[model samples]
Target: METFLGVDYATLWFLVIGGLFTGYAILDGFDLGAGAWHLFLNTEKDRRIALNAIGPVWDGNEVWLVIAGGALFAGFPVVYATVFSAMYVPFMLFLTSLIFRAISIEFRSKEPMRWWRQSWDVAYSLSSVLLALLLGIVLGNVLQGMPIGENFEYVGNWLEFLNPYAFMVGVCTLGLFMMHGAIYLIMKTEGRLFLHLSALVQKAIIFFIVSFVITSVYTLIYFPHLSDRFKESPALFAVPLAAFLSIANIPRLITKKKYGLSFVFSSITVSMLLIMVAIELYPAIIMSTFDAAYTITVHNGSASEKTLGIMLLMAAIGAPLVAFYTGFVYKTFRGKVQMDENSY
Candidate 1:
């Protein structure tokens, strides 16, 4: 119950964990997005350029994910234990996709055979799309509720994670990442390639808008509880409003050939949407579908206050170092990708 600036340590840890994952989602989301475009880009040179575009920084971007996962495990061991144990299949699929994604990037250019490159191309694109989908499904499932019982055990069937709502959320996540990736690709190409990617950016814009709108409508109609908080407290509505504006700005920026600015908004859109999710499910890490009494609140799911405090102190010292290095890598490799013999 220790307070930091009037917020309890638990709540602060929740914010820290959320912020770290948000950073992961934004950084890795583009990598996945760029991979999603691999097959659609036409020609091996285009794909290689796309690969090298992210090459210098893609693996480094994953460090945020590792840190985020570790932070969650440290700050909320109960939530971490239950989620990883119960949602075994989805997490495994996620891990598999992550590995395949890395493999596709590394192995795609190792040979001169068309079949070999095409094989890795398919692996890269499919894995990226699947990874995005799995992330969405897990989040959707979490947003809906868990089937935890007394003693904080997962009592329901693991296959229940495949419900309709989760699939819809998964699709939305894919579309959003695709759009985000298209915008990044624009920044990494020129001339004909840029025009081709411009067309893709347009298509991705429409795709995400349609997916986002459809998912929003479905949630509003069938998932009332998720929106109840914003409805009751009108101020919380700004999050969604900002999300709308961010999504809207991407197209305008693209039209103006301002892809750098567009990518910034793409990052913001992901952040705002996740922040809204955090707002909708505050205090409660996982709501129990079977009984409200069985729900896992931050207090129930977290570690000892001392453990959280120590981990938080570590994050405070460590986050900036990670961010600084990440920014440095990206800055060093910024601008259009110039592929050479050493390129991916």
Candidate 2:
């Protein structure tokens, strides 16, 4: 068992994979959130402005998702295999939504016809909403435990993935992304559209807060195991505390007309919530409903130490470059979106 900074390679790889997905969630989250708001912009020009707000960065943001997937496959093949196998329908639907989203964004502005634009707008918004829900449902199922029987194999039916708890998480995820998207929109638009989004963002904030409260109550009541870690170590409660404070600060920032700071807090809220999930499920990647002994954990599910070490070295070299590139793109595109001929 190789160790880096007193942590095993498996644990390190787990953290790496988690970090990659967290990046994806934060970066692409607003894109999905913005798309989720597509149908609500009220006019063609409003829609176009919203669309172009994310134009330069959406595809680049998706790069994080791609990297995260690759990291998952490399670092935890068993969990990857089992999860993909178990949630085949959801993942396929997710991929379909992703395709529709991309095509909707590209195709919406390709024509001037009212019918054509309207059709694509619906597709874009629906796909974005579905994508957010599916991501949450998948995560909810993972948190609740899967029906892994043996050999780290998932023996559950696809329909089982849509249980009540998962749906609540899905709704919660959608609300969070919508709020995040609204804040981003407020930051990027001005005049009538900015005012519209400013009002809409308040509703989004309320939506997310309500959904979060319901989901938290459900998890604490039905999935008590999630809170076990916090109970065992009282200080670990700070993650959720931070999550609460961050969520609280977003509305505060928005009210103060500090949308740029609001966006920062929104990103922090996403990161903190994911961190709490990581804390709740440390060591175990996927819990087994059939039997606790059959759970897939970092130690049992990870690639060989040598493989993880090599990949860790690769991530170390590549991560900084990716971060730099992402920063460069955001920096280049920073400030209010102005529409021109090149705008989407």
Candidate 3:
């Protein structure tokens, strides 16, 4: 018999994972979109507007990532340890890039020299690209399964990590985020910059559409086990179909010049894709290539019932507060970014 505590634990895990990704899409989406359009911003004023568009909210956006990580650590320590231990190098690189990007955003303004500012801007853009790619690769690796021994430890060498399927997944992830970022910038900025950013988004959307199609086909053909899962779980197909439909809606949204709608559609595309991936990997938190029995699932990988219960209680109180604070921040700062000498 299931207790209320067990149900609560399950519900809280779903909420935290879903909420973090949603928050990430809504918050980091604009920043990434702004960075994607950075090269097109020819004037300092344009660049500053791009920068300020994300200024007040970027710090807050990072909180979701922290929460996600903390939830993973506390609720699923085994998965956390295995993932981090296996992918230590990539994780370090990801963290380093994020740190530099965050610091550079603040420090760039303080530098009076053109070269210094330009250097930081480049760092910001590159870091964003790397971070997105790393996330993609990580997702790809999870989906494709890793070499896990009987002891539930990773057995594959670092070099063998970049398989063809994983690479394709990485490409898909990178392209999707780039497109997601572009849509975000189109919604947030105005004037010639907005027009230019819109064009960039259109191009990116096309690229991602092609990549998505190719990746979908590849996954179907090469990953027969996953394809079998899709066949077995007919209901799960809705997620990817929704993602595809969202992709299709982008052109119409763009044609109408409905930037906000375009952004929404782009976000839907991402959210649906994530949902599809999660569905595909259901019950298996971490799949094992070396040993089938070694696969980690929510039942086996999750924390103790008592700990999960307490975490659920804390999340119940905290999640609403997070939502309210995020909404307030966005509402308070709602407007086109204006460039000023003091802008940072």
For all candidates in order, the CA lDDT equals: 0.90, 0.94, 0.78
Which residue pairs does candidate 1 place in steric collision? none
lDDT value for model 1: 0.90
Off by over 4 Å in 2: none
Local accuracy of candidate 1 as per-residue lDDT tens digits, 126-177: 9999999999999998898889888788988879899998999999999999
- Candidate 1 deviant stretches above 4 angstroms: none
Candidate 3 lDDT over 124-195, as tens digits, reads 888877777777778888888888776678888876656777777777777777777777666667889888
For all candidates, what are the clash counts? 0, 0, 1
lDDT of 2 by residue, 45-148 (tens): 99999999999999999999999999999989998999999999999999999999999999988898999999999999999999999999999999999999
Best by TM-score: 2
The all-Cα superposition gives candidate 3 an RMSD in Å to the true structure of 1.9
Clashing pairs in 2: none
**Model 2, C-alpha of 222: deviation from truth (Å):** 0.7
